[model samples]
Target: MDRGTVGSAQSGRLLVEVREEGSSAVVTPAGELDHHTADVLREPLEDCLEKGYARLVVDCSRLEFCDSTGLNVLLGARLKAEAAGGGVHLAGMQPVVARVFEITGAEAVFTVHETLDAALAD
Candidate 1:
């Protein structure tokens, strides 16, 4: 149940918090997830994988905005997780962010949940 922050105040536009939940690593990213801030999310995700956590849950309840770069990061993580016999699950997406996934057909590729509890339950 260790929790840590991955983003820095000086260079990071996004704030990512990492926590362990069961066998999964939960990454909560807040603020804008654009090209400039994608690394904030990426670093924690990679760390989770390196630590042998293949099941990832991205709690997007506080995520205010997301761009194509953000989507790309998630997709790449999904690929890596799946290759490791685990997967990336998304939960609590905002309308705008959800629309981005829907428009890009990424919704079909990801397992979306209505809440963090739901994601964890699955």
Candidate 2:
């Protein structure tokens, strides 16, 4: 894989990293998040909910791509969390991914932050 290219930093595929900070949960998703890797986000998100985390932050700083499938996963997670009286924040979206949200009119539905710290603070 070529260095500095998209999705090359961690095996040219999606990598979801989850951690807990106080009562909040952080899930940092890196790499492509099209149909093939949408499920990569599901488990960690579900785990956070199962662990009773009411505050969730999804750090998208390293995410290289996202398709409709990826968007669906995010939407589902958002609904599930909000239904449970919790909410999810999207952090550090790349331009391409952010455009997808904009095109789909999902930007208004999510609480998007420019950084993980900002998301966590909210």
Candidate 3:
């Protein structure tokens, strides 16, 4: 699979990497995903959908933080993917990040996995 970076690294807040795993597009976003950096993740995710990659796995093992903005982006992606007869899976969330999903009841909305491999298996 070809690996590449998405978005400018100059922001120093987030780094998004895009790669393909099997039939799924895996997006790994590191650093803080807040209002300011949410777009960093959005663009690549949208690209995956546009490319007809309906099965998307977000490998968040390196993700340090996530706020409402980040959640919104995930939710939007989920909706879009579902409409396209695909689905978005979130994997390896940090405790703090997982807490955000739990607090907002988004855990029920998304398919959460303990590892990227597990998500890919699904």
Candidate 3 per-residue C-alpha lDDT over 81-122 given as tens digits, one digit per residue, 9 for 90 to 100:
999999999999999999999999999999999999899889
| Poorest lDDT segment (10 consecutive residues) of candidate 3 | 2-11
lDDT of 2 by residue, 1-122 (tens): 11121111123488887777666777888889888787778877887788787667788998889999989998888988898898889999999989999999998999999988788777
Q: Pick the candidate with the highest TM-score.
A: 3
Model 2 regions lying over 4 Å from their true place: 1-12
Ranked candidates (lDDT, high to low): 3, 1, 2
lDDT to native, each model: 0.89, 0.81, 0.89
| CA RMSD, predictions in order | 2.3, 6.9, 2.2
**Residue pairs in candidate 1 whose N, alpha carbon or C atoms collide under 3 angstroms:** none
TM-score of candidate 3 relative to the true fold:
0.92
Off by over 4 Å in 3: 1-10
Error of 3 at 9 (Å): 6.6
Error of 1 at 77 (Å): 0.3
Query: Comparing candidate 2 with candidate 3, which one achieves the higher TM-score?
Result: 3
Could you tell me the lDDT of residue 65 within candidate 1?
Answer: 94
TM-score of each: 0.91, 0.88, 0.92
